[model samples]
Target: MLEKKRVQQLDIPSREGYDAIFNSNFLEDVPAALAQWGSSRVLLVSSKTLAAQHGDRIAALQSALGSHRLANTKLGVGSHSPYADVRDIARRVQRLRADCVISVGGCSYSDACKAACLLAANLAPDFTEEDMEALVDERRGIADARPEDGTPLRPRACRLVAVPTSLSAGEWNALSSATNARTGKKQHFGGWEGGGQPDLILLDPELAAATSPERLWLSSGVRCVDHCVELMCNPESAEGRCEGLHGHAERGLRCMLGGLTEYKAAKTRARGAGEKQQQQQGTQEEKEEAGDKERQLLLEGVSECQYGSREALTGLLIWRVPMGPSHAIGHQLGAVANVMHGVRLLATPSPSPHSRALISFKTRPVSNLTLPPLQITSCVMLAPVLRWQAANLSNPHYKTAQAKTLAIFNETLGWREASAADAVERFVRSLGLPTTLRDVGVVSDEEVRRIADKTMTDVWGGGKRQMEFDDVMEVLNSVRG
Candidate 1:
C-alpha cells in the first residue's frame, strides 16, 4: 500500500463541453436544444417502466422538440443488454428515422439507445448472430482486446447523448456492453471508431431522484464495491486503488462504509415521510463529499465480493476481479440457492484479498437465492462434480442430485472439502450453505481433491491459486471442523 500516482478518477464528461445540461425527466431541456439546433422530429426513447411513470414528461419533451417530432420508441421487456434485443431496438429506431436518440433511465435503457445510434449512423454491420456474439465476448471482462480490422457492424455507428439514472458510470465511458445470448456472455462495443464514445452526457441527480432506497442501496453497493474490488485486484492498474500504493484502499473503504451509512440514513428518512431522492438541498461540498465517499467505497471493498455484486455495471469499463472458482461455484449455488445473484457473496466468507479496512455489515439481508433457473449443465465447477457427472450422467435420482448439489454447497461455505472429520458442516450450518460434498453428493475426500484440482482450472476464468487438491480435501475434511 505505498504507490502514489495511480488513481482511477471518475471521468466527468461535463468537462468535454455540452451545449445544454438536461436535468432529469428532461422535458425541460428538450425545447431549448431543439430550437438551437433548428431541427424537427425529436424522438423520445424510454423503457416500459419509464413510459408508464414519465410518459407525460416524455410527451412534453417531444412537444418541446418542436413541430418535427417524427417518432419514438419505448423499449423494455427484452433484455436490451443482449445483442439480439439491441439489434431489434436498432431496427425499430431505423424505421422511426430518429435524428437523435435520448436514452432515458439506467444502463440497460441507455445501452439500447447507444446500439440504435450505431445502426442509424451506419457504424455497424449486418445483424448476424455470430458477428454480434464475437463482438460481445471481446468486451466482457477487464481488458481491451478489440480487433484492429474491426468487423461487419463497424460502419453503422452514431453520436449519442446519455442520461444515466444509476452510478454505473456509462455516461463517462465510450463503450457499451451487450450480452451475446448465443454464448451467454456480455459483449463490448464502441471504444473504437463509430461506437467509440458518447458525444455528450448530462448527469441530473433528478434522474437518480427516481431511485428507491432498496435499489439505490443495491446499486450503490454494487458500484462502490465494484470499484473497491477492481482496485484491489488491479493495484498496478493505471486507475486503481492505492493501498500499498497510497491510501486509496483506505479511502475506498471509508467510502463504502460511508455509503452504507448514507443509505441507512436515507432509508430512515424515506420511511418517515421524506421522498426517495437524497435531499439535494445540501451544499455542493456536501454532495461532492457524498460522491467521493461513494467512489471511495467502490474502490475498496468491491474486490472482496464476487462478480455478481457488480452486475449493475456489468459491461462498463470498470476493473473487476473476474469471479473466481468460489463465485462460479456460487453462481451454481445461486442457480439453486434461495438467495439473489450477489447476496451469496456477502454470506460466503471470502478470503481477505483487500489491503485495507474491514467494516461489518449491519444486517444479514434476506436473499431470494434459490435452486431453479440454474441449469448447471455445463458450468465450470469444483472437481467431484466432474467425477460425479461423468460417473453417473443418467442418474436423476436424489443421490446423484445431491452429489451434484454438493459442488455448489461446499464451495459456498468455503469448506476445504466436505468431510466427516471435524463437523465443519456445523459452522456452515450456522451460515446455512450446504455442509457436505455428500450433502450434495460428493462421496469422498479423494473426490473432493479431484474437484478442487478441477475447479482451480475451470476455463471460464478463475482458479484456486492456493486451494489445490489438498486444499479441497481440507474443506472436505473440515466437514467435521
Candidate 2:
C-alpha cells in the first residue's frame, strides 16, 4: 500500500535542474521567496487573460519588486509557443538585460520563456530566422550547443522562475517545444542541461483554480494520467535498469485517478446544489457562504490533482523515460491541426446540439452555439497503444510490462476487465471526456498521413519497437471512430 501523506509546503527535488515549491500561496509567499533568489531585474511573461484575471495580485507583485527591478512585462503569448513570439521575448531579454524571467501561465508560456532565455544566452545579438531553423535542424539543444571557440557555453545569464496556472506540468523540466510559424511545425528545444529550466517553481492550487477553465483543468489532469500510464507500460521500463521508477508511476496513477474522481463528484454535487438553491430562492448571504464552501471543496480536489501531476512528472523526468506514441502523435496534432494539448475526442456530440442551443438561448448569443470538433487527448490513445504493444512486440519484457500495467489498472480502478485499453476508455468516459479521432474535425486522409509522417520525426515517437508508418496508421485507425 502507498503512503497517504498529504503535501502542504514541500520542496520537490529535480534530477539535475531547478527547485520546486509546492502549495504556495503566490501573492503571500512569492515576494519573500524572490528575495532569496536576489534577482534585481525580473521580466514577467504571461497571457492577457491571466493578467486581467489577477491584476490586483500582479500589481502587488510589481510593488514588491519595485519599478526599476521589474525590468519589462510581456503579455499576449499565444498557444504552442510560436517561434516568432519566442524571438520577440528573446530580444526583450537581451535589450532589457534582465537577470531573471518569471513566467506566469500554462505550459506554452513556460516553454516560450525557456526557449527565449536559451536563445538570448546562446544565439547572436541579431540572430535571424534561418539561424533559429538551423539550431533546431542540427538538434543542438542547450546541452550540446557551444561557442565558436569550442569552449563550453557560459552558465545561463538569466534565471527562470515559473508560476504555472494550468496542470500541463511543463515547469518541471529543462526541455521545451516551440511552434515554427514559417513551417507550421512544432520544434523541440532544450536538453537536460544548462539554463533552460526554472530556478524556482511556485505552485498554488488556489491560483490555478482561479485562472484555469473547468474543462482545461480537468483535462490536463488526464494528461498527467497519460504520463504515469505511459511510464508504467513502457517496455523499456521492465528492464532492471529503471525498475524502481515503476513505484513512482504506480503511486502517481493512484493519486491522479483518486483526485480526478473526487473532483468530478464534487463538481457535480456543487452544480446540483446551485440549481436547487436557485429554485428555492436562497438568501444572498447564505448563497455566498455556500459558494465559498463549494469553492473550498473544489480547491481540495485541485490541490490533490496538482500533487498527482508533480508525482507523475517526477517519475518521467528522474530517469528520462521515453513516452509512447500518444505523446508523439499528439504533438503533431497540436502543431498541424491546432488542437489543444488536453482535448479528448468524443465519438458523439457532447451535451448534444439541441441542449447546447437551449443553454445558449438562455445565457449566450446564437452565434456561440456552434461547437468545434473534438480532438482526443494523448491519454485517450495510451490504452490502444498498449494493446498494440501486447500483440506485436514478441519480447518477454514487453509481455511482462503489459501484464503489470493491466494489474495496476485493475488494482487502482477496481476493474475486473482484461484489457487495459478498455479500462482507460471507461475512466475517460467517467470524466465526461470522449475517445476517438473522427471527432478531430473531419481529418482528411492526407492530413492523417501527414500527422503519422511527422510522428516519425519525434524523438519518442514509436516507443521501444520503433513503430513504422503502417504501425502508426494501425493505431490511428483503431481510435479513428
| Best candidate, TM-score | 2
- All-Cα superposition RMSD per candidate: 13.4, 5.5
Model 1 CA deviation exceeding 4 Å by range: 1-25, 34-41, 77-80, 119-126, 134-157, 192-195, 211-213, 238-260, 273-481
Q: What is model 1's C-alpha RMSD?
A: 13.4
lDDT of 1 by residue, 168-217 (tens): 44444445555555434444455432233444455443444443223423
C-alpha TM-score for every candidate? 0.51, 0.84
User: In candidate 2, what are the lDDT values of residues 350-430, reduced to their tens digit?
Assistant: 442111211100111223222221223564467667778778877787666666766776787677756666566667766
C-alpha displacement of 430 in model 1, angstroms? 19
TM-score of 2: 0.84
Q: How many clashing residue pairs are found in candidate 2?
A: 2
Best by lDDT: 2
Error of 2 at 144 (Å): 3.9
Residue 426 CA displacement from its true place in model 1, Å: 22
